[model samples]
Target chain A: MKNLKYLISLIIGHLTVFKHIFKKPVTLEYPEKKIELNDKFRGEHAFDVEKCTACGTCQRVCPSFGTIEIEKEKDENGKFYPKNYSIDLNKCIFCGNCVQYCPFGAIKMTQNYELADEKKSTLKLEINTLKRNYFDNIIDK
Target chain B: MDYLYFLYLELLHKWNLPDYIAMVTFPIIPFCFVAAALIVVVIFLVLAERKILAFFTQRKGPNRVGPWGLFQTIADAIKLLCKENITPEGTDKFLFTLAPLLAFIPVLVVWGIIPFCNEFDIISFSINSLLFVVIAAIPILGILLAGYASNNKYSLIGSVRSVAQAISYELPLIFVLLSIVVLASSMNLKQIVLAQSSIYPFCGYFVFPAFLGFVVFFACGIAELNRCPFDLPEAESELVSGYNTEYSGMKFAFFFLAEYAMMFIMCAFIATLFLGGFLSPLGFYVGEKLIPNEFLANLSVYFEQAFWVFVKTFFLIFCMIWVRATLPRLKSHQLTAFAWKVLLPLSLLNLLIVCLIKAVL
Candidate 1:
């Protein structure tokens, strides 16, 4: 039976060789075919200010010390609202807890998956840039 | 290098009797060429695989080398080649030297019987040449040799795992091969390719109807190659380079090249058998339209032949890479159990089906 096994393997060895000759290769020539990432992809974090209620939920929930800060101001209706809030992108783990606990749906996850930066300050992100500049663009629109 | 080539060429001529005789003696010529091709394919496979994984995992793989990092492999290869070769002092020097060669020989040897041409016009290999199965055993032996010779406890452990996995996986692979042999009714790879040239009605190229064997064959092949999920022998984070732990320099490079080479050969083999070697996907027309002239069409068929082989190999390599990116390496015991418990029974069943179909048809 053992010798029989050797003969059998010898006789049939080419099946693997022949079967592989003419199928569409699984290689996707990239740059030509850019893979699309999903919107809520848990990549590195991007922050939005218009979405941020400035309730400091992001800063408060953050376990990492000195990672986040929120500055408050009076809105047009005299209601206290977030004027300036900054989360150290380096410190922020993208825990999404800030996004989750936001009572106002102001904080959002962006599709910008890439977050590599050379400068140290680049890591210390200000969420205002990611905000929808609705008032700034209202007249332009 | 030129002097060396000259030396090899002189040696080849000295040994040459007829083209057929020369073919057997001069396996190194074709072997070298094939090995080179596999290395290139492996690089391409690595890049494509990383990119695919990045896509699935929601990230971009290396995109900085050339536009979208097409030349990333060249850079990486240069990097590895240039890096320091660190040989551990507390190792068996001779066995350490031999280990990578042991790990690599199987990949080269397996290429011996791949039927690349239909009419068998160009090559001087015999009318009845089938050496691939024999070559397949070389790497298994090589891995075992590497593990023992490395003289590391982890290396010892990995070598044992490799032995166990190779023994268990060998059964299903052979069974799957048996199914194909039954279909073609010939052990010769060229004969098998000739068998596939004429399209059949139901059992088309042993993929459909006999697809169960194809699946099992592919799975076993993956385990045999010691790739992801089955990468117990070289489970990097755990075993610390596994069987070749003490290797360094060109020695390490040889092992690296051989690992990729095995991947390329196994992938190509799987693609050729189940997918249809060098035959146009629809069995015609791609070649016809590419060159309206009949003579050109004949030329295009050769391209089509090479093209299909390339494509199939690339796809299988991609799948291997995909599994690598997605799944963690399998535990040694789990790897054995999967080969025995899941793959073995399924392949046996697949063999039974193929036999029944062959008997009926």
Candidate 2:
């Protein structure tokens, strides 16, 4: 039995290497090929002024304190709406918690993953400036 | 004395250079080239082995430096170089300094004998076959140098252990080598390779009658290299650096470089010994006969031979890495005793079987 095991091992040893001969060699060569970050990539967050009801739902949903900020404006009708909905995109975890509870798809994730900026403040997401490419791509195709 | 003569002939006589320059600079070039090449090969082998193992393990290996971590070795070299050339003051400074080089140079010289491609041939053959064995015998000296030179307690123990381990494995490895020489009846490696050509067609490799010999040789060769499972000397968690506890800087790197160079050579040696030494496995009889162009046929023949040889060697290397990552290192006595009680006996049986087969055939 030991001899059989040894013989089996000896024969199987060379054969096992063949398993990797055609394997999907897990190497990405990353710099050469950018990662195919999925649409559900859960990346930097964007603000949607047209849709955000300004219920302060997102601010409450944000686990990281000071990640989202809401400004208020009162109309003559005595109704309050968000004057500005801003997110420190740097602090946003892209947890999609805000997305789940968002009654209106006001704040959501964007596809822009390379968010690196020279200035720290460059990462700030102003509702007015937030590009809707994430939503646009979702709808366009 | 001999090397100094090689220095003069190569530098002064051949190049018509000044004796001072020849003596000072010329000898250094081969050494430096060898040293540099060995270092580079070791780094490449380590990266490659890691990457290949990662492939098997389903993960990305060091992929940060210079795209796929090509510069990772450079970073390592820099770090190792800058760290420290610390020698325990009580150590035999000269031998401690020399140990890694001694452990290293044999592996490098083995490459001097191995032919990589048809064009990569580097060995110079001579009358006495003893020279090949004599040069091949240098690694033991290096192992001894490493063991005895370092004055540390563990280094002394590890060196002695390694010497025993190395010498025990050496017997089987040599027997396998001799088995090949018996078949080809030539000590010259080039002749051994030439004999593997498609003259007999199906029998290009010496693996048929010598199959057991080749297998035993490869197994013993791995043990001789002192890799994992067989890595008794530097079995970390026991002996910190084994024989290399006291070595550092370029000396340590030389040892490191030598280890990988030997691994590469061992693969090449296995290829040369069994897989038809640069003879196209497919080119056996048919292609050689049908192809009108001799050069084209021979070129294809060599290319085919080189491919199989490379495949076999790399596969073995991958196996070594797998064993390294999978198994535990053997104890010192178990390491030597296994060689004596198991591999030694098996190799002798293999030798007898091979002889009987030859006699009957």
Candidate 3:
């Protein structure tokens, strides 16, 4: 009978729920356990000092003004190295254009994406921190 | 000496209290116990429902609090208590303030007649079955008042839907309960439980012959409580938070508590009516065999009876939660039609069958 099937189906539905009680939950508890990001994830920028030409290509390609600042100051050999290189993460959209357009791959996106900070000034990445991060993450690892 | 009688005398003697004062104080004691126990049970029931629902949906619910989110409801309760009690602008201030209390107080009041065990019974009124029905219906009036007093259109529509759903479901519920009344030959809840103890053709729980009615009663009860699968009144997509739309902070908490408490009360009522109340499901013979020590055995019986009552009640509550997790909310028309067309006729037939069996026997 149709009613009998309905009753059996109801029992089956309940059994399904009962079965799920034993199954492992799929939720990854935030902060304690973060999901692994893919290779393509456009995250924090890392600057390779040895490879960077200080050609100001990154600053020019950046769509958002005031995000990437590159200053050229001549070294003792009269070759230009960046005098003041800064990336304001507050303005950087993480579009990866800076990483993509770099001919020498001087700038790269890192796997570290936990970028939240209490202060606005802290979010801005300086040349020293960027170079340190690049050497520490890319060259050493 | 009867221990109850011994305690009665010793209490009066120790306190130097008069007989009238002792008698007056005796009833208030169980009332306080029931009130305390109900709140504690509601707190756990809310947590259990959320956890079970999460499990059914295959997600971890509320695991951020104390281990496995055990204290999540406590944190929620504290937050509700601390939040600003907001009364929206241009509302009927007096009735709006009164509505949540109206919704809440009746649920605690209904526990006045519900017997946990023979010794723990507060009221033990002869017509407690009828008393429960009357008291349970009173919350709807509060819900309606809440909707009207809020001066909100969504709330008014929700109140109307709630009333419609409640009235339709109430018919089949009362009818099913009436069938049980016919079988038990008394309206007292304690008497109904007692009547189920006699094993005539089999263990004389009316659930066997009145299976149809039991099903009807449960479905109607879900509708009456405005729970999921029958929760059209507060349908999230249709009406924003329903009758309690304008309520906030502790007032909203009252409505929330009352709903969960009512769920507990209904589950306990089902246990009493159809699942043999505080009596062991395996019966006394099994209990005796399981425990041979006379002193411990005697002590265990009282505790065991109360424990079984809680077990049966919680099992029924879990089933209700399971249903909530499994089923989708019914359309408003389907909800009404199912009550009138399917459950109403089935309950009527069930009542007729019960009366015929009662008369023949």
Error of 1 at A125 (Å): 18
TM (chain A) per model? 0.65, 0.76, 0.81
Between the candidate structures 2 and 3, which one is better when assessed by TM-score? 3
lDDT of each: 0.68, 0.71, 0.86
lDDT of 3 by residue, A5-122 (tens): 9889989988987899889998888888989888888888889877777998888899999899888788898787888889999999989998988988999888788899999998
lDDT of 3 by residue, B1-361 (tens): 1355558768798978778876667667767888899889989899999988999888999887899899999999999999889898878999999989999999999877766775666666788898899899988988998998999999999988999988898888999999999999999888888888864432788788788888888888888899999887788898998999988899999999999999999988988888878877775634456788986766677777788889989998888888998888888888988888999999999999999989999
DockQ: which candidate is best?
3
Off by over 4 Å in 2: A6-10, A88-92, A115-141, B1-91, B107-137, B140-161, B175-199, B202-206, B232-249, B267-338
Full ranking by lDDT = 3, 2, 1
Candidate of highest lDDT: 3
Q: What shift in Å separates residue A13 of candidate 1 from its native position after superposition?
A: 32
TM-score of each: 0.65, 0.68, 0.87
> Candidate 3: misplaced stretches above 4 Å?
A1-15, A54-88, A95-103, A118-122, B1-6, B14-16, B83-90, B198-204, B285-296, B353-361
For candidate 1, write residues B77-188 as lDDT tens digits: 8877887866576666677677677777666556645655443222224332235555676777777777777668888887778878888888888887777777878766
Q: List the residue pairs that clash in candidate 2.
A: B102-B142, B103-B142
Better of 2 and 3 by DockQ: 3
